[model samples]
Target: MSMVRYKAIIAYDGTLFHGFQRQPQGRTVQEELERTLSKMASQPIVVHGSGRTDAHVHALGQVIHFDYPKERPLEKMRFAMDTQTPEDIAVKQVEIVDELFHARYLVQEKVYEFHVQIGKPRSPFRRHYASYYPYPLDLAKIERALPDLLGTHDFSAFCASGSSVEDKVRTIYEATMVHDEALSELVFTFRGDGFLYKMIRILVGTLLKIGNGRLEETSLPKIIASKDRNCAGPTAHPEGLYLKEVKY
Candidate 1:
């Protein structure tokens, strides 16, 4: 039978896994996907992700691709995998695709969302998925600093320490901050060509700092110009981050 390439859209609650990538210890999305697919195929299988979402970071529509025998009906396979995989992980869609199609390399853009619970105490329901900031935030100030983040710039200041990627520049196609009064939560959404490790979280941390009067809004341009990681604010917690979408 001819080998066929299969593309899949997946969603996972990352709280249980070490991260998207397989590790020496602890569960991971990739490890589980490969293991389940390999069992069905009766051979070792590999799956590639659009990008890695850090530990406790959830994905609403993470994309991946792998190969399987042409004899496998994708609809049946998707159902089977969904039934067999852990409850936190779900195979949303599976399709046969062009041999050249690759999940990571063809990615044109990505969207990530960071959630923050503001004022008083953290919500028990959102504790594993939202960062809690007890202090009042100046919403207007946070909105003002967001525009400087649009367009292309070297975001070295917003990237985490020990990242090996040399190109620190990334283009922000769009970004916004919205306050959900009903939930008492502040939501930050980002769409970009790509992101460095912990980039979104660090960006949120800096915005929070600015909102709380710890960082000057006018200093944003200078911070980007500095290119030093020390110029940025603290790295926000991983739980508040979600890989909202992976655009091809």
Candidate 2:
């Protein structure tokens, strides 16, 4: 029988897994999915993700594609995959697609969100979900600074050093920050054609610095222009980052 191409949207609480990609030693989201899929297919199966999420980083709409050796009902396959996956991961939707569809290569855009709790005592419940910041933030300054990040640029400054991809140019379609007054939390939304490794986390860290006056609001242009990783701020905690959506 010929293999069938299957595309799936999934969400996972990544706190326990090492990351999205499979590592020889640590647990990973891909490993769990592949294990379940291989068992169901009665053969080894490989699952390819849209992209990788760092350890402890969550996903609400991550996408993946895999090929199964046999034909099966899409709904049943989705249900089986969902139920068989560990508690942290969920198969949201599944569909058959053309053989040429490639999740990573065909991706057109991605949305990411980074959350921070501010000026409040830490909540035991949210310790692993939201990053905490005790400093006073100037929302106006941060808002004003966000526009500087829009449009195309070489974002090597914001990228972590471990990334191997040589082409660092990416376009930002939208960038916004809003405060959730009820939770005393700051929510950052970034829509871009692509993001470098740990790009959003590093951007959030720099934005926090600018918000708190450690870095001037006007510093974004200079920092981005530098294209030097050391010119950027630290990478934020993985706990506070989420892969909100992937657009193909």
Clashes of each: 0, 0
Q: List the residue pairs that clash in candidate 1.
A: none
Least accurate 10 contiguous residues by lDDT in model 1: 66-75
Q: Which portions of model 1 show Cα errors greater than 4 Å?
A: none
Name the best candidate (by lDDT): 2
TM-score of each: 0.97, 0.98
Model 1 scores what on Cα lDDT? 0.90
TM match of model 1 to true structure:
0.97
For residues 107-132, could you state the per-residue lDDT of candidate 2 as single tens digits?
99999999898876887777888889
Best by TM-score: 2
lDDT of 1 at 186: 91
Model 2 Cα shift for residue 158 (angstroms) = 0.6
Clashes of 1: 0
Cα RMSD for candidates in order: 1.1, 0.9
